[model samples]
Target: MVFRHENIRITIIAALYFAVAIAEVMCELYAYKPLIYVFKPLMPAMLMVLYFNTSRKRSALFFIVMTLSLITNVLFIPDSQDLLFYGLVVFLAHRILLLYYIIRLLKINDYIPAIIATIPFLLVYFYLFMITNGIPENSFVVLIFQNILISFICGIAFSHYVMQDSRRNSWLLQCGILFGALHFIVFVEKFYLTGFSPTIFRPMAMGLNAFAFYTFYEFVMATEKSHRDDARSIA
Candidate 1:
């Protein structure tokens, strides 16, 4: 019975991580993009965040994926090739930037991390929207705002889930999902507005959702810890 429970737990975690990625990929294949498709990875990439192992591993894997994703993206949609390169560079910079935010998160409150981590993305998107591309109707800002909240909430949920059993993977995944969801929201808006079809957005989202595996894992751990603490108090 115990073995069965463990296996079931594992399956549930894996499934949560996988679902977002698969959904985004399917969306891309079926939907593609009508205008600027910055939101290519719509759902799939969210799941991928859970798969990253350690710091070194995460950096290396991220670099490789960013490179490959950029390459594939350029070949598939050659128009935004230069922009994609720039985007990847910016993403690389985020690794360092994330270090700064993580420090802030741990030092301050949990919510601070999300704001510090995601605000830059919003700023960048705003610049790209208004300056690079003419700003959309201010009314559209509401849509963007909602997306930001979605990403932030998703990050919190993912982070909480990852705290369970992911070890280092949990912390890293939490950060990834937090930022990934925010980015996804931006790219999707780009797609809707411009018609530049970039698949990175969806993949990024999947990567974020992958942290769901870690989220549930963390929940279990917290529950166990609480029980143990109670038992200790009783003793």
Candidate 2:
């Protein structure tokens, strides 16, 4: 019965996600601000409901990430540069926390995979840097910083996924990285590139965020099950 309830809850949350995605597209089309507020917080709120467990470190960290995301979203709704700057700082902090949490399970022995993962990061970074060299000083710095940070995260994610024996967490992490790439594209479009980025990318970026939360939940479950199995063996 609990399992059934969990599945039902997951289904409902997924449905809501799809609805929010539609609303996102419509909001872009119509320039609706209310829809932004309604859906911006829904992802994290539902993430907490789906993954919250007092005993799990990943759960708590993810909750913090999402809470910060919600706050940042609210701050971005205003036109003030100061508010946006503060939001970026919080967002960067969230990324650092997330990076720490994901890397916690990794060990020094994982260096091979980690090094291999950096190839793509270097490739993407050089390509973007070459193309956007003409951007303004302050904006260029922010764009470069964001790109580097995201690339580093993606590199770590890919490397960790490669070294996993079960491959379950690895695939989830990889998928999350894929979505993260989409979000990166959105960031580039919004900050560096000119012209209207299609509203369609909005939901695509959010979809990546949903994938990240789900990946964390799965990691927590995997860790808890391993602990339980270890306890049984000891008994």
lDDT per residue (tens digit) for residues 122-208 in model 2: 677658666653344544556556566667667766666666656445654664476457646656555545355665665566555
Tell me each candidate's RMSD, in Å, in order.
13.0, 3.5
| TM-score list, all predictions | 0.39, 0.76
> Which 10 residues in a row give candidate 1 its minimum summed lDDT?
50-59
For model 1, what is the error of residue 105's alpha carbon versus the real structure, in angstroms, after optimal superposition?
A: 13
Model 2: CA > 4 A from native: 53-58, 76-82, 106-109, 133-143, 165-167, 227-235
Q: On residues 1-235, what C-alpha lDDT tens digit does candidate 1 reach at each position?
A: 9878866765664665455346545555455554214433322233234333212123343334434443333333334544544444444444343344333333335565455555655565555445435434443454355445434444443444444453433544554555555455545545444565555655444444334334433433433445556679999
Candidate 1 residue 188 Cα shift, in angstroms, is: 5.3
Q: Give the TM-score of candidate 2.
A: 0.76
